[model samples]
Target: MALTKLVQLENFRKRSGSETSVAKVLSYSYASPLLSSPLLSSPQVFNCTQLDDLLEVYYLSPLYALEFCLGFPGNLLVVIGYVVCLQEWRSINIYLFNLAVSDLLFLCTLPRLSWLYANGQKETSPYACIIRRIISYFLHVNLYSSILFMVWVSVDRFLLIRHPTRNHFLLRPKVAMAVAGLSWLAINIQVAPLIVLMFQDMQKAINSSRCTDFASLSGDTNSFGYSMGLTLTGYVLPFLGLCLSSYNIARLLKVQDAALQRRTTSYKRPLRVVTAAAAMFLVLYSPYHVMRNVRIASRQEWSGMELCTRMYIEGLYILTRPIAFLHSVINPVFYFLMGDQFRELLFAKFRQLLRKTGRQRGAT
Candidate 1:
């Protein structure tokens, strides 16, 4: 067996052995297996790091599986409903359609993640390594793209409601398309450093036994600054956008439509989704954001307690992945259940399916 083969069997295939034992097994291809000493027969410990094992069993594996379970049906309905609305696309629905697509793309990657996490991310195949990295790289871009598009949608809603006089300038579908395309381009630029860092320093990452982006960098100012800067941008920019959009939306809601102000001082659903979304975003993301900055800031003066704090924060961070993704699963509730148009679409689809089945039965 090849070294890579041993790596797979020991990890994924769950065949037991130490490195020496596996090396001996491979040595048969090179020399005589029967000429082995006691070292040759010793069992091989897997290439999977201890952290990988713990994360796989305790968090990463379960979260990957759970996210897929929750995400597939959630995003699928949103995508289908979103697609049906394409003929009459507003800027809001356009962004929504894109959000659905991005979420779907992420869902497509979940199975590979589940498999890798189940096997403790040993990365025995170089192709597997490359594929995983590429998926992650695109996911990195999509993260920013999705957030910006979402914020833009909220901002659009804000402008149309709050400043209707000035907002009509951007209400065109052509303009929305251009903005979305440009947003994606910007995200691609932002994510360039990740690709370079991954490809250039992957060997060092593997050697570090930390299977994450931060582990690959050298102990230099440039590397430190680059890593921290990317992480901060990933968090801070989207957060600011969300904050501004939310504030504007709140302002719009408060204005009471000028006409409705005479009748009532309330909203239909009381802004529950808005509050919940904002709260969950902070809860799920803060630990990861905090840890990323702290990791960079204290690179030189590493504290044992700080390291432990970061590890605990990472635990929080891993837990947060599914929670953050749960946003996709939850978003359609507001889009479909809340919207009159989408509800009508669902009913029409149901009626159409029932009619199709009846027609088939009549033919029989």
Candidate 2:
């Protein structure tokens, strides 16, 4: 009877173990749906949690505000300076004019970005989300368009100095306009898919106000690829183009005939303008592009960097981004300081404004 009881006890233990195993399987079955749900699977939800609030408030907000304050009027003056001298618009000036317009459009988005940063991510309305996406779209448009037009200007200057008689057809005002239009079209086409993806992602986040945080997007692989591609096309290639153009122009400036040099004294201002532009691209824009790539890499799953390292990269990106915005303000300064024609026109406009104010005062 004792042996029988031992057997029954062992059997009971096996039954209980089976029951426990079955219960675990049932629990896992029930939990799988929850794990697979969109809310749980969405990467943005986790990315948003990881975002450094301190970086946004103390650094990005103030910098964006400062950029807005300076860039708006600065870019506006550049546009006005070009516009006031419409009759004098050459192929090169057309490119510069478009660059100023791109900068102005970019500056328009800063106030909204500033407000978004200052307020933090509250529950964003759908309209607000749409507006933010549009702004972000144009921000990128401005960036690449500016780079492209600057390349055009550099190439034009290069040809003027290096091969003045080779590409006479390309130096026409109509040809410049056509090139500018084609550039705009190409950029818009490149960015259209990205805009669509952004909008779709924003729509999915029904209550999120963080429209500008691309780091919070789904699919790390896609984002990483896009960022890398943008870095290459938008920055690396253009920078190489500028460097080559500048080098050629510099060599030509050094080795020209004395009579040709005397005749080209008027070209000194444009040469200075081109040199300043190249320097600006190197100093202000290169760091931002490098940091942007680093930041994007840190956001990827395979980066394998520590949290502190990632945070450092994020901070560096924020700092460098504002430096890029400084280009808008500084470009106008380049125009006024380097381009005698731009300065003359700007001064004439100011004088006309002052005279009008005096006339109004006298009438009053």
Candidate 3:
């Protein structure tokens, strides 16, 4: 039965084109129960160019554009509010402000990505690939930077709750600024290797005409190991830190509730903030990381229908990319929620401007 299918596929390939190779080895389980576990000596290689291009055009392009449009206003407002309205900066404010800046930078890269995805087939210029590589570098920079900043924000909030006196050295703005600078340096260090890998991928004839996301780049064996290492240090550690921070805050809240024999709304706010940050991390980051690892693994040796399944996983990975970035649009909410003084000051500034405008109109 396998021989019959093999002959048929060979004939089809010959008729299609000699240059195109679909699958070197095919595995099928449809014949009978015994054929389900049939062993294959070699791995199957299926070309996913068409699928990649299709998803790039239809799936990623529109999503990136929409994310940029929706995320820009909120992130810009947060940046402006932090710079103009907020008179004093706290540790959380510094962290959240950095996060807002990171989101804005990330969002700024999306339009170029969208255009690349939309017109990827036509983009053959060397400069375009260079721009894509640079954009990809900054995208990861902002992504992991935002993650680290949020982790700091959560930990800072927890410490503030643990010590209401606010005497924690790490809670100082200068200390926080230094931490933010180190966070940027750390994320850049983590993402620096990607640009080299992406350059090597561009040398491949398969990737000659296009640039792909790091997970989607083939022809490089080192990318898989690098990706695993990146996921570990860039995401896993920060996620764990966030979880620990949230857990400690919750425990403190519980102890306070029990000791006071009453549930005070004051403690609940920090508890809610940390818990929400943790929830956001889980909801947004987890799937992207899981699917990214899976996507990389899918490029490994596999045969038959498993290759087809990997194709579907690739599509799912593509979908997760934009969803993970939804954090940019959502971070502004945190900006408003985490910084009471910022929010209040922002509203007051707006009100003052409105009153001035009203008085000027009356004078006219």
Best by lDDT: 3
Tens digits of lDDT, candidate 1, 1-364:
2454456433421211112244443454235453233343322222222333576567877787887788778788878866664357777666767777877887788778878777766676666677878878766665666566667666666656555554576666778788888877777887787776666556544543224434223322355566567666766677677777677666667667655655343342324444454565676567655555454444333332322233444444455455555555565665653342666776787798899999999999
Residue 329 displacement in candidate 3 (angstroms): 0.8
Model 2 Cα shift for residue 161 (angstroms): 3.6
Candidate 2, 1-364: lDDT as tens digits: 3343334333322311112233443343235575346555334323422345556777778888898898788888778767766566678788888888888888888888877877764434778877877887887788778778878887787777666664677788899899999999988876676665675566555555556555444431376678778778877788788777777777777677444646557555556667777788888888887887777677555775543355567666777777876777676665565442677777877899999999999999
Which residue pairs overlap in candidate 2's backbone? none
Minimum summed lDDT over a 10-residue window in model 1 is located at: 11-20
Estimate, for each residue in 1-364, the C-alpha lDDT of model 3 and write its tens digit: 4565465445433321122343542434233343333442112212332455578899999999999999999999889988998777888898998899889998999998888889963457778778888888888888788879989988898888878888989988899999998898889899988977876667763435556677766555476788899999998899899889888988988887778896669777877877787788789888998998878776654322343465677778887888888889888988888885888899999999999999999999
**Clashing residue pairs in candidate 1, if any?**
17-43, 17-44, 17-45, 18-43, 18-44, 18-45
Candidate 2 minimal-lDDT segment of 10 residues: 11-20
lDDT of 1: 0.58
The full ranking of all candidates by TM-score, starting with the best, is 3, 2, 1
Deviation of model 2 at 70, angstroms: 1.0
Q: lDDT score, residue 220, model 1? A: 24
